[model samples]
Target: MHVAEEQKPAKKSSKVKWIILLLVLLLLAGGGAGAYWWFFLRQPPAQAEQAATEADKNATKGAGKTDTAKSEGRLTTLPPFLVNLADPAGRRYLKLSMDVEVNAPAAVKEIEGQTAKVRDAIILLLSGKSYTELAAPEGKLLLKNEVADRLNQILGAPRVTRVYFTEFVIQ
Candidate 1:
């Protein structure tokens, strides 16, 4: 009977220990989630406002996109551009076809109205890059971003959301 009583106490103590361990684990998980929310999920106020503005633009009519895509934006295809790379050793060229995503119909009209200036800017930008500068995937992304940034500046707003290199060939 004494041995039985002692065993009961031991079992109760072990259960308490187990409950404590489970609580600690739960606390750790909750803290991790909180940190993730703070660090990764939260956006700066300026960026949040920008995103909200873009969403408003997307919801407007005459965005030139299907239902699903119009919820985000629209794409406008640029004429294919072929430029000789700044290769000194030999002749190297890049033929690139691209599309730009615009925020709204006003942006599209602005882009269309400045097609000549846009093309000239792109041609100058592309013709300055050598084959080595554009051979890698990262290089292409940088080029796309630069074009978007430049176009946005010329258009006097953040109208261009993204640039797509639909076709890229180097020789």
Candidate 2:
């Protein structure tokens, strides 16, 4: 009878130890899941918001610069010129009509004030060109740059940004 009584208590102790271990494991798993959620998943959203704010600030600065450029006046046209050819035949010529766009109001006023000088300079430049030189794309670009430079020199500033060809004919 005494042996049986001791064996019964030993079995009850083993069962209690197993139940305690299972409860401890469950608690540890739940804690680890909670830590992962707090540290990794929840932190990136704030960082993303900061990045968005910085992008908006840069966009606003760019918009301001564009607005300032718009407030300045513009020039739409310059007088046309007829350029004779430099070839040995000397029979071909080009008629060039271009428009100049200026960004500065004072520079536009300056160009308007000295129209005769500008016209003379353009005539001199065009009279020296040839038909073959004026027909190519590279030649056209070079001519535009030269015209813009001459206009800027007369205006005394880097006011002209582009020169557009309204008419170009070779004969």
Name the candidate that leads on lDDT.
Answer: 1
Best candidate, TM-score-wise?
1
Report, for every candidate in turn, its global Cα lDDT versus the true structure.
0.90, 0.81
lDDT of 1 by residue, 1-171 (tens): 989999998999999999999999999999999999989999989999999987876776457755556546688999999999999975899999999999897888788889999999999999999888899888998999999988998898899999998999998
> Model 2: per-residue lDDT, tens digit, 1-171?
999999999999999999999999999999999999888777587887987876766697778844333633476677777767676788887787888888876777778789999988887877778766777999999999998899888887888888889998889
Q: lDDT of model 2 at residue 51?
A: 76
**Candidate 1 Cα RMSD (Å):** 7.3
Worst 10 residues of 2 by lDDT: 65-74
Instruction: Point out where model 1 deviates above 4 Å.
Output: 1-71
